[model samples]
Target: MDIDKLSIKKKRVMIYFIEAARRLMASEGVRALSIRGIAEIAGYNSATLYNYFDDLQHLTLFASMSYLRDYVSALSGNLKPPMSSLQRYRVIYETFDHFAFRSPEIFYNMFFGRQSAKLPEVVVQYYALFPEELKEHFPSVRKMLTQGDMYRRDEPIVEELVRDGFVRPENASPLSAVVPRLNQTYLHELVNGKDISPEEQHRRFIAVFDYLLETAK
Candidate 1:
């Protein structure tokens, strides 16, 4: 549903529901989410929640995004100018891993799970309803957060590498493709209880990423 088309009252109700879900996810984690639970916290019944969202997963996706605030906020400090495009990319991913590994399930569901395809639209809807959450980000950072496709999100950085002559034009696509896959490999394991510490996970990911960059050059 287009949130922009909704009545003011309806938009308010949806915010209530989304906020309730966010509270639950923050307090108890994503696995504890349920339609009844969200509706109860929102001061509505489950049927009313359906009026605002297609299903629990839909609501969960929006709720999970609340976790991204920390990641997005950290980028401002980590991605200072005078850094090369490749350095910026590395900092971005490292910053991402710092937050993502701590909440692997939420990150996995938001980016790699079945509902991930709907994320671009959901992100638009989310910001429409809560534009305040976006006001602090720089324009480039805003664009990066709103880009829902993991591959497309990283493609520009790879293209920057090509423009800067760090990578050949022919290698840009493959470099973009492999980087996300490599991250996903670690994320998938972490999500599945791989028994790795977040610190170890961060180190491993950067080591492998550095190796890939060397090979791509």
Candidate 2:
């Protein structure tokens, strides 16, 4: 549907359904999400939901995009200048850590749940709703929107580390590799129902990142 063509009533109903999905995911986890369940919460018949959304996946994706505001908010504040690329990289992970650990269910569904959709598509869709000011914080989105593939801003950061002699040229590949390992570890722990204290979480992330830095050198 052309969002511009949506009537006021339709827009309001869509918002309610998205909000209902958010509440259900927050309260019960992603496993509890269903078209019928969300429709019941929104006080509409299940079939009525199809008027606004393509399917349950479409609704879930829309609901998940709501949290990107927080991600952009967290990232935008910490980008003050004189910061190194390495420092910026750390800040990105730190912000993501706080976001994902706080809402693992939503994170999983938004990201890891559907193997069907690509990350670049999800990123484009989420940021389409981003306010203009917030959109300024994400340069990668422009490339992803144009190219229709995941764009890693960190790849250049790792390259810079090698060029600056912070990382040995031969070890540059693993520096990039380490970040996704850290991400996977976080998801693994969350999926296994293991909890780490905030302090430990901070310590572990820093430890792993530091190890990569040291080994790269």
Taken over the whole model, the C-alpha lDDT of each candidate is 0.84, 0.68
> What TM-score, to 2 decimals, does candidate 1 have?
0.88
lDDT (10s digit) by residue, model 1, range 78-168: 8878999989989989988998898998888777777777877888899999999788778866876776543245887888999998888
Query: TM per model?
Result: 0.88, 0.72
lDDT of each residue in 26-139, candidate 2, tens digit only = 788777999989999999999999987777877787777656556656666775577876776778778776787666666655556653254455454444443463356456
By summed lDDT, which 10 consecutive residues of candidate 2 come out lowest?
A: 142-151
Clashing pairs in 1: none
| Backbone clashes, each candidate | 0, 0
Q: Return the TM-score for candidate 2, rounded to 2 decimals.
A: 0.72
